[model samples]
Target: MDTTQLLKGVLDLAVLAVLKDEDGYGYDILRRLRTAGLDEVGDASVYGTLRRLFQAGLLNTYVVPSEEGPHRKYYGLNAAGRDQLNRAGKTWRNFASTMDALLDERGVAA
Candidate 1:
Protein backbone atom coordinates (compact mmCIF):
# COMPACT_ATOMS: atom_id res chain seq x y z
CA MET A 1 0.00 0.00 0.00
CA ASP A 2 1.14 3.53 -0.71
CA THR A 3 1.32 4.91 2.81
CA THR A 4 1.69 8.47 1.56
CA GLN A 5 -1.96 8.45 0.60
CA LEU A 6 -2.78 7.09 4.02
CA LEU A 7 -0.65 9.75 5.58
CA LYS A 8 -2.47 12.45 3.65
CA GLY A 9 -5.75 11.33 5.15
CA VAL A 10 -4.49 11.25 8.72
CA LEU A 11 -1.73 13.84 8.82
CA ASP A 12 -3.88 16.43 10.53
CA LEU A 13 -4.90 14.01 13.24
CA ALA A 14 -1.35 12.80 13.69
CA VAL A 15 0.04 16.30 13.91
CA LEU A 16 -2.59 17.33 16.42
CA ALA A 17 -1.96 14.23 18.51
CA VAL A 18 1.78 14.91 18.69
CA LEU A 19 1.15 18.48 19.78
CA LYS A 20 -1.43 17.53 22.34
CA ASP A 21 1.06 17.25 25.19
CA GLU A 22 3.66 19.69 23.98
CA ASP A 23 4.28 22.45 21.47
CA GLY A 24 6.86 22.28 18.66
CA TYR A 25 8.08 24.16 15.67
CA GLY A 26 7.82 22.88 12.07
CA TYR A 27 11.07 20.93 11.91
CA ASP A 28 10.60 19.71 15.46
CA ILE A 29 7.09 18.47 14.64
CA LEU A 30 8.41 16.73 11.53
CA ARG A 31 11.18 15.11 13.53
CA ARG A 32 8.74 13.95 16.18
CA LEU A 33 6.53 12.35 13.52
CA ARG A 34 9.47 10.61 11.91
CA THR A 35 10.80 9.47 15.27
CA ALA A 36 7.38 8.06 16.07
CA GLY A 37 7.78 5.75 12.98
CA LEU A 38 6.29 7.94 10.25
CA ASP A 39 9.51 8.04 8.28
CA GLU A 40 7.74 8.67 4.98
CA VAL A 41 6.24 11.98 6.12
CA GLY A 42 7.58 14.78 3.97
CA ASP A 43 8.84 18.07 5.37
CA ALA A 44 6.81 20.12 2.91
CA SER A 45 3.67 18.19 3.74
CA VAL A 46 4.11 18.66 7.47
CA TYR A 47 4.87 22.34 7.06
CA GLY A 48 1.85 22.80 4.86
CA THR A 49 -0.32 20.98 7.34
CA LEU A 50 0.89 23.27 10.10
CA ARG A 51 0.05 26.32 8.04
CA ARG A 52 -3.40 25.03 7.22
CA LEU A 53 -4.12 24.12 10.82
CA PHE A 54 -3.05 27.54 12.00
CA GLN A 55 -5.16 29.22 9.36
CA ALA A 56 -8.10 27.10 10.35
CA GLY A 57 -7.75 28.38 13.91
CA LEU A 58 -7.13 24.89 15.23
CA LEU A 59 -3.67 25.77 16.44
CA ASN A 60 -1.94 28.57 18.30
CA THR A 61 1.50 29.77 17.27
CA TYR A 62 4.16 31.82 18.99
CA VAL A 63 7.74 32.64 18.24
CA VAL A 64 10.72 31.72 20.35
CA PRO A 65 14.17 33.02 19.54
CA SER A 66 16.92 30.54 18.87
CA GLU A 67 20.64 31.16 19.01
CA GLU A 68 21.39 28.68 16.28
CA GLY A 69 20.02 30.64 13.32
CA PRO A 70 16.57 32.28 13.54
CA HIS A 71 13.46 32.56 15.62
CA ARG A 72 11.32 29.44 15.74
CA LYS A 73 7.53 29.58 15.44
CA TYR A 74 6.03 27.02 17.72
CA TYR A 75 2.55 25.50 17.43
CA GLY A 76 0.32 24.21 20.18
CA LEU A 77 -3.22 23.00 20.37
CA ASN A 78 -5.92 25.42 21.39
CA ALA A 79 -9.27 24.32 22.78
CA ALA A 80 -10.65 23.78 19.29
CA GLY A 81 -7.60 21.77 18.31
CA ARG A 82 -7.88 19.61 21.42
CA ASP A 83 -11.56 19.02 20.74
CA GLN A 84 -10.73 18.06 17.16
CA LEU A 85 -8.00 15.70 18.29
CA ASN A 86 -10.32 13.89 20.65
CA ARG A 87 -13.02 13.49 18.02
CA ALA A 88 -10.59 12.39 15.32
CA GLY A 89 -8.89 9.94 17.65
CA LYS A 90 -12.15 8.22 18.43
CA THR A 91 -13.12 8.10 14.76
CA TRP A 92 -9.75 6.59 13.84
CA ARG A 93 -10.01 3.93 16.52
CA ASN A 94 -13.47 2.88 15.39
CA PHE A 95 -12.43 2.77 11.74
CA ALA A 96 -9.30 0.78 12.56
CA SER A 97 -11.29 -1.71 14.55
CA THR A 98 -13.70 -2.16 11.67
CA MET A 99 -10.86 -2.72 9.22
CA ASP A 100 -9.15 -5.15 11.55
CA ALA A 101 -12.28 -7.21 11.91
CA LEU A 102 -12.86 -7.22 8.18
CA LEU A 103 -9.31 -8.41 7.53
CA ASP A 104 -9.60 -11.04 10.24
CA GLU A 105 -12.71 -12.42 8.66
CA ARG A 106 -10.83 -12.71 5.39
CA GLY A 107 -8.07 -14.69 7.10
CA VAL A 108 -5.50 -11.98 6.46
CA ALA A 109 -2.42 -12.14 8.66
CA ALA A 110 -1.40 -9.18 10.70
Candidate 2:
Protein backbone atom coordinates (compact mmCIF):
# COMPACT_ATOMS: atom_id res chain seq x y z
CA MET A 1 0.00 0.00 0.00
CA ASP A 2 1.10 3.54 -0.68
CA THR A 3 1.79 4.88 2.79
CA THR A 4 1.32 8.47 1.76
CA GLN A 5 -2.42 7.94 1.54
CA LEU A 6 -2.42 6.28 4.93
CA LEU A 7 -0.38 9.14 6.33
CA LYS A 8 -2.95 11.60 5.02
CA GLY A 9 -5.71 9.88 6.98
CA VAL A 10 -3.81 9.97 10.28
CA LEU A 11 -1.52 13.00 10.01
CA ASP A 12 -4.00 15.16 11.87
CA LEU A 13 -4.20 12.74 14.74
CA ALA A 14 -0.44 12.22 14.79
CA VAL A 15 0.29 15.92 14.86
CA LEU A 16 -2.30 16.45 17.59
CA ALA A 17 -0.85 13.60 19.60
CA VAL A 18 2.67 15.00 19.34
CA LEU A 19 1.48 18.36 20.56
CA LYS A 20 -0.30 16.79 23.50
CA ASP A 21 2.73 16.90 25.74
CA GLU A 22 4.06 20.31 24.73
CA ASP A 23 3.93 23.12 22.22
CA GLY A 24 6.40 23.22 19.32
CA TYR A 25 7.25 25.25 16.30
CA GLY A 26 6.79 23.95 12.75
CA TYR A 27 10.22 22.47 12.22
CA ASP A 28 10.24 21.11 15.75
CA ILE A 29 6.93 19.35 15.19
CA LEU A 30 8.16 17.88 11.90
CA ARG A 31 11.31 16.63 13.55
CA ARG A 32 9.36 15.02 16.36
CA LEU A 33 7.10 13.20 13.91
CA ARG A 34 10.04 11.83 11.94
CA THR A 35 11.72 10.82 15.17
CA ALA A 36 8.58 8.95 16.14
CA GLY A 37 8.86 6.70 13.01
CA LEU A 38 6.80 8.76 10.58
CA ASP A 39 9.70 9.41 8.28
CA GLU A 40 7.43 9.65 5.24
CA VAL A 41 5.59 12.67 6.63
CA GLY A 42 6.32 15.69 4.49
CA ASP A 43 7.11 19.25 5.54
CA ALA A 44 4.17 20.72 3.63
CA SER A 45 1.76 18.23 5.15
CA VAL A 46 2.75 19.08 8.73
CA TYR A 47 2.56 22.80 8.14
CA GLY A 48 -0.79 22.47 6.43
CA THR A 49 -2.14 20.27 9.19
CA LEU A 50 -1.11 22.87 11.75
CA ARG A 51 -2.92 25.54 9.81
CA ARG A 52 -6.08 23.49 9.49
CA LEU A 53 -6.13 22.52 13.15
CA PHE A 54 -5.64 26.08 14.25
CA GLN A 55 -8.47 27.20 12.00
CA ALA A 56 -10.63 24.45 13.42
CA GLY A 57 -10.11 25.88 16.90
CA LEU A 58 -8.23 22.84 18.05
CA LEU A 59 -4.91 24.60 18.56
CA ASN A 60 -3.53 27.81 19.94
CA THR A 61 -0.57 29.55 18.38
CA TYR A 62 1.93 32.18 19.35
CA VAL A 63 5.24 33.41 18.08
CA VAL A 64 8.49 32.99 19.92
CA PRO A 65 11.38 35.16 18.93
CA SER A 66 14.57 33.30 18.15
CA GLU A 67 18.08 34.69 18.08
CA GLU A 68 19.22 32.30 15.39
CA GLY A 69 17.03 33.29 12.46
CA PRO A 70 13.30 33.98 12.47
CA HIS A 71 10.46 34.02 14.94
CA ARG A 72 9.00 30.57 15.48
CA LYS A 73 5.26 30.13 15.55
CA TYR A 74 4.46 27.58 18.21
CA TYR A 75 1.39 25.39 18.28
CA GLY A 76 -0.23 23.93 21.36
CA LEU A 77 -3.39 22.01 21.98
CA ASN A 78 -6.39 23.66 23.57
CA ALA A 79 -9.19 21.87 25.41
CA ALA A 80 -11.10 20.97 22.26
CA GLY A 81 -7.94 19.50 20.76
CA ARG A 82 -7.35 17.25 23.74
CA ASP A 83 -10.95 16.17 23.62
CA GLN A 84 -10.70 15.32 19.92
CA LEU A 85 -7.49 13.44 20.52
CA ASN A 86 -9.11 11.24 23.12
CA ARG A 87 -12.05 10.49 20.85
CA ALA A 88 -9.91 9.86 17.75
CA GLY A 89 -7.56 7.64 19.74
CA LYS A 90 -10.40 5.40 20.80
CA THR A 91 -11.66 5.17 17.21
CA TRP A 92 -8.21 4.29 15.90
CA ARG A 93 -7.70 1.61 18.53
CA ASN A 94 -11.03 0.01 17.75
CA PHE A 95 -10.40 0.03 14.00
CA ALA A 96 -6.92 -1.37 14.41
CA SER A 97 -8.15 -4.11 16.66
CA THR A 98 -10.77 -5.10 14.14
CA MET A 99 -8.22 -5.20 11.32
CA ASP A 100 -5.84 -7.28 13.43
CA ALA A 101 -8.54 -9.81 14.13
CA LEU A 102 -9.50 -10.04 10.48
CA LEU A 103 -5.90 -10.56 9.43
CA ASP A 104 -5.35 -13.21 12.08
CA GLU A 105 -8.42 -15.14 11.02
CA ARG A 106 -7.17 -15.13 7.46
CA GLY A 107 -3.85 -16.62 8.60
CA VAL A 108 -1.77 -13.57 7.85
CA ALA A 109 1.58 -13.71 9.65
CA ALA A 110 2.53 -11.00 12.04
Candidate 3:
Protein backbone atom coordinates (compact mmCIF):
# COMPACT_ATOMS: atom_id res chain seq x y z
CA MET A 1 0.00 0.00 0.00
CA ASP A 2 1.08 3.53 -0.68
CA THR A 3 2.12 5.32 2.51
CA THR A 4 2.53 8.80 1.12
CA GLN A 5 -1.04 9.81 1.82
CA LEU A 6 -0.89 8.63 5.40
CA LEU A 7 2.52 10.24 5.83
CA LYS A 8 1.22 13.60 4.72
CA GLY A 9 -1.43 13.56 7.40
CA VAL A 10 1.12 12.89 10.13
CA LEU A 11 4.16 14.80 8.97
CA ASP A 12 3.31 17.78 11.15
CA LEU A 13 3.04 15.58 14.21
CA ALA A 14 6.33 13.87 13.36
CA VAL A 15 8.09 17.18 12.91
CA LEU A 16 6.67 18.52 16.16
CA ALA A 17 7.70 15.41 18.01
CA VAL A 18 11.20 15.57 16.58
CA LEU A 19 11.60 19.14 17.80
CA LYS A 20 10.14 18.42 21.22
CA ASP A 21 13.41 17.69 22.94
CA GLU A 22 15.90 19.71 20.95
CA ASP A 23 16.27 22.33 18.27
CA GLY A 24 17.66 21.40 14.85
CA TYR A 25 18.58 23.01 11.58
CA GLY A 26 16.88 21.83 8.36
CA TYR A 27 19.37 19.17 7.26
CA ASP A 28 19.98 18.16 10.84
CA ILE A 29 16.28 17.65 11.38
CA LEU A 30 15.98 15.62 8.17
CA ARG A 31 18.89 13.43 9.17
CA ARG A 32 17.47 12.84 12.60
CA LEU A 33 14.12 11.81 11.14
CA ARG A 34 15.84 9.45 8.74
CA THR A 35 17.87 7.97 11.57
CA ALA A 36 14.67 7.52 13.52
CA GLY A 37 13.43 5.19 10.74
CA LEU A 38 11.56 7.74 8.71
CA ASP A 39 13.80 7.12 5.74
CA GLU A 40 11.07 8.02 3.28
CA VAL A 41 10.97 11.58 4.61
CA GLY A 42 12.25 13.98 2.02
CA ASP A 43 14.44 17.02 2.55
CA ALA A 44 12.03 19.48 0.97
CA SER A 45 9.10 18.16 2.98
CA VAL A 46 10.89 18.58 6.29
CA TYR A 47 12.22 21.99 5.34
CA GLY A 48 8.75 23.09 4.25
CA THR A 49 7.24 21.74 7.43
CA LEU A 50 9.71 23.79 9.50
CA ARG A 51 8.86 26.93 7.55
CA ARG A 52 5.14 26.29 7.88
CA LEU A 53 5.33 25.58 11.59
CA PHE A 54 7.42 28.65 12.14
CA GLN A 55 4.99 30.77 10.18
CA ALA A 56 2.10 29.35 12.15
CA GLY A 57 3.72 30.57 15.40
CA LEU A 58 4.21 27.04 16.62
CA LEU A 59 8.01 27.04 16.42
CA ASN A 60 10.85 29.29 17.50
CA THR A 61 13.77 29.98 15.22
CA TYR A 62 17.26 31.27 15.80
CA VAL A 63 20.37 31.61 13.71
CA VAL A 64 23.72 30.20 14.72
CA PRO A 65 26.81 31.23 12.84
CA SER A 66 28.98 28.38 11.64
CA GLU A 67 32.77 28.55 11.46
CA GLU A 68 32.97 26.05 8.64
CA GLY A 69 29.88 26.84 6.61
CA PRO A 70 26.86 29.10 6.35
CA HIS A 71 24.82 30.19 9.33
CA ARG A 72 22.19 27.67 10.33
CA LYS A 73 18.67 28.53 11.32
CA TYR A 74 17.45 26.19 14.01
CA TYR A 75 13.84 25.45 14.91
CA GLY A 76 12.53 24.55 18.32
CA LEU A 77 9.13 23.98 19.79
CA ASN A 78 7.50 26.80 21.72
CA ALA A 79 4.60 26.92 24.18
CA ALA A 80 1.99 26.79 21.44
CA GLY A 81 3.81 24.02 19.69
CA ARG A 82 4.01 22.01 22.88
CA ASP A 83 0.34 22.48 23.50
CA GLN A 84 -0.37 21.40 19.96
CA LEU A 85 1.85 18.38 20.32
CA ASN A 86 0.13 17.28 23.49
CA ARG A 87 -3.34 17.68 22.01
CA ALA A 88 -2.47 16.12 18.70
CA GLY A 89 -0.76 13.21 20.43
CA LYS A 90 -3.96 12.35 22.26
CA THR A 91 -5.95 12.49 19.05
CA TRP A 92 -3.48 10.36 17.18
CA ARG A 93 -3.38 7.75 19.93
CA ASN A 94 -7.13 7.44 19.88
CA PHE A 95 -7.18 7.16 16.11
CA ALA A 96 -4.43 4.59 16.07
CA SER A 97 -6.13 2.45 18.69
CA THR A 98 -9.35 2.50 16.75
CA MET A 99 -7.57 1.49 13.59
CA ASP A 100 -5.75 -1.27 15.39
CA ALA A 101 -8.98 -2.71 16.69
CA LEU A 102 -10.58 -2.51 13.30
CA LEU A 103 -7.64 -4.25 11.65
CA ASP A 104 -7.64 -6.95 14.30
CA GLU A 105 -11.33 -7.53 13.81
CA ARG A 106 -10.71 -7.95 10.11
CA GLY A 107 -7.86 -10.36 10.74
CA VAL A 108 -5.39 -8.00 9.20
CA ALA A 109 -1.90 -7.51 10.54
CA ALA A 110 -1.23 -3.99 11.69
Candidate 4:
Protein backbone atom coordinates (compact mmCIF):
# COMPACT_ATOMS: atom_id res chain seq x y z
CA MET A 1 0.00 0.00 0.00
CA ASP A 2 1.06 3.56 -0.54
CA THR A 3 1.69 4.66 3.03
CA THR A 4 1.07 8.27 2.23
CA GLN A 5 -2.40 7.53 0.93
CA LEU A 6 -3.15 5.35 3.92
CA LEU A 7 -1.87 8.00 6.28
CA LYS A 8 -4.06 10.60 4.67
CA GLY A 9 -7.16 8.53 5.44
CA VAL A 10 -6.24 7.92 9.06
CA LEU A 11 -4.37 11.09 9.87
CA ASP A 12 -7.23 12.45 11.94
CA LEU A 13 -7.48 9.29 13.99
CA ALA A 14 -3.73 9.13 14.44
CA VAL A 15 -3.57 12.72 15.60
CA LEU A 16 -6.41 12.23 18.04
CA ALA A 17 -4.84 9.05 19.36
CA VAL A 18 -1.54 10.80 20.02
CA LEU A 19 -3.28 13.62 21.85
CA LYS A 20 -5.06 11.08 24.01
CA ASP A 21 -1.72 10.43 25.66
CA GLU A 22 -0.74 14.03 26.19
CA ASP A 23 -1.04 17.49 24.68
CA GLY A 24 1.71 18.46 22.20
CA TYR A 25 2.64 21.25 19.85
CA GLY A 26 2.64 20.77 16.10
CA TYR A 27 6.30 19.87 15.65
CA ASP A 28 6.26 17.71 18.73
CA ILE A 29 3.21 15.84 17.45
CA LEU A 30 4.91 15.34 14.10
CA ARG A 31 7.98 13.96 15.84
CA ARG A 32 5.88 11.58 17.90
CA LEU A 33 4.05 10.34 14.81
CA ARG A 34 7.34 9.76 13.00
CA THR A 35 8.81 8.01 16.02
CA ALA A 36 5.70 5.85 16.19
CA GLY A 37 6.46 4.60 12.63
CA LEU A 38 4.52 7.09 10.52
CA ASP A 39 7.64 8.39 8.83
CA GLU A 40 5.71 9.44 5.74
CA VAL A 41 3.49 11.96 7.50
CA GLY A 42 4.35 15.30 5.99
CA ASP A 43 4.72 18.53 7.94
CA ALA A 44 2.12 20.41 5.96
CA SER A 45 -0.46 17.67 6.22
CA VAL A 46 -0.12 17.43 9.99
CA TYR A 47 -0.32 21.16 10.41
CA GLY A 48 -3.35 21.31 8.21
CA THR A 49 -5.00 18.51 10.10
CA LEU A 50 -4.41 20.41 13.33
CA ARG A 51 -6.03 23.50 11.95
CA ARG A 52 -9.02 21.57 10.64
CA LEU A 53 -9.54 19.69 13.85
CA PHE A 54 -9.28 22.89 15.86
CA GLN A 55 -11.78 24.63 13.65
CA ALA A 56 -14.12 21.66 13.85
CA GLY A 57 -14.08 22.07 17.61
CA LEU A 58 -12.51 18.68 18.13
CA LEU A 59 -9.30 20.12 19.54
CA ASN A 60 -8.29 22.98 21.76
CA THR A 61 -5.10 24.96 21.27
CA TYR A 62 -3.00 26.95 23.68
CA VAL A 63 0.24 28.80 23.23
CA VAL A 64 3.27 28.11 25.34
CA PRO A 65 6.49 30.10 25.44
CA SER A 66 9.55 28.38 24.10
CA GLU A 67 12.94 28.89 25.61
CA GLU A 68 14.87 28.49 22.38
CA GLY A 69 12.41 29.57 19.75
CA PRO A 70 9.00 31.10 19.14
CA HIS A 71 5.99 30.18 21.21
CA ARG A 72 4.41 26.87 20.29
CA LYS A 73 0.71 26.25 19.87
CA TYR A 74 -0.17 23.09 21.72
CA TYR A 75 -3.20 20.96 20.91
CA GLY A 76 -5.27 18.95 23.30
CA LEU A 77 -8.45 16.95 22.87
CA ASN A 78 -11.60 18.41 24.37
CA ALA A 79 -14.82 16.60 25.35
CA ALA A 80 -16.14 16.51 21.82
CA GLY A 81 -12.82 15.23 20.59
CA ARG A 82 -12.88 12.33 22.99
CA ASP A 83 -16.38 11.44 21.84
CA GLN A 84 -15.34 11.60 18.21
CA LEU A 85 -12.29 9.46 18.88
CA ASN A 86 -14.38 6.83 20.56
CA ARG A 87 -16.84 6.71 17.69
CA ALA A 88 -14.16 6.70 15.05
CA GLY A 89 -12.21 3.99 16.84
CA LYS A 90 -15.26 1.75 17.00
CA THR A 91 -16.00 2.31 13.34
CA TRP A 92 -12.44 1.53 12.38
CA ARG A 93 -12.45 -1.66 14.40
CA ASN A 94 -15.60 -2.87 12.74
CA PHE A 95 -14.35 -1.99 9.28
CA ALA A 96 -11.03 -3.69 9.87
CA SER A 97 -12.66 -6.83 11.13
CA THR A 98 -14.96 -6.99 8.13
CA MET A 99 -12.03 -6.59 5.77
CA ASP A 100 -10.07 -9.22 7.63
CA ALA A 101 -12.90 -11.70 7.24
CA LEU A 102 -13.17 -11.03 3.53
CA LEU A 103 -9.43 -11.45 3.08
CA ASP A 104 -9.46 -14.67 5.02
CA GLU A 105 -12.28 -16.03 2.91
CA ARG A 106 -10.38 -15.16 -0.24
CA GLY A 107 -7.29 -16.89 1.05
CA VAL A 108 -9.30 -20.02 1.73
CA ALA A 109 -10.73 -19.97 -1.79
CA ALA A 110 -7.28 -19.46 -3.26
The TM-score values for the models, in the order shown, are 0.98, 0.98, 0.96, 0.93
Clashes of each: 0, 0, 0, 0
Q: Candidate 2: minimum summed lDDT over ten consecutive residues — where?
A: 1-10
What lDDT does the true structure give each of the candidates?
0.97, 0.97, 0.93, 0.94
lDDT of 2: 0.97
lDDT of 1: 0.97
Any runs in candidate 4 off by more than 4 Å, and if so which?
A: 108-110
**1-110, model 3: which lDDT tens digit per residue?**
77788888999999999999999999999998889888889889998999999999999999999998999999999999999999999999999999999999999965
Model 4 is weakest, by summed lDDT over 10 consecutive residues, at 101-110
- Candidate 1 residue runs with Cα over 4 Å from true position: none
Model 2 TM: 0.98
Model 3 TM-score, 2 decimals? 0.96
Ranking by lDDT: 1, 2, 4, 3
List model 2 lDDT by residue over 1-109, tens digit each.
6899989999999999999999999999999999999999999999999999999999999999999999999999999999999999999999999999999999999
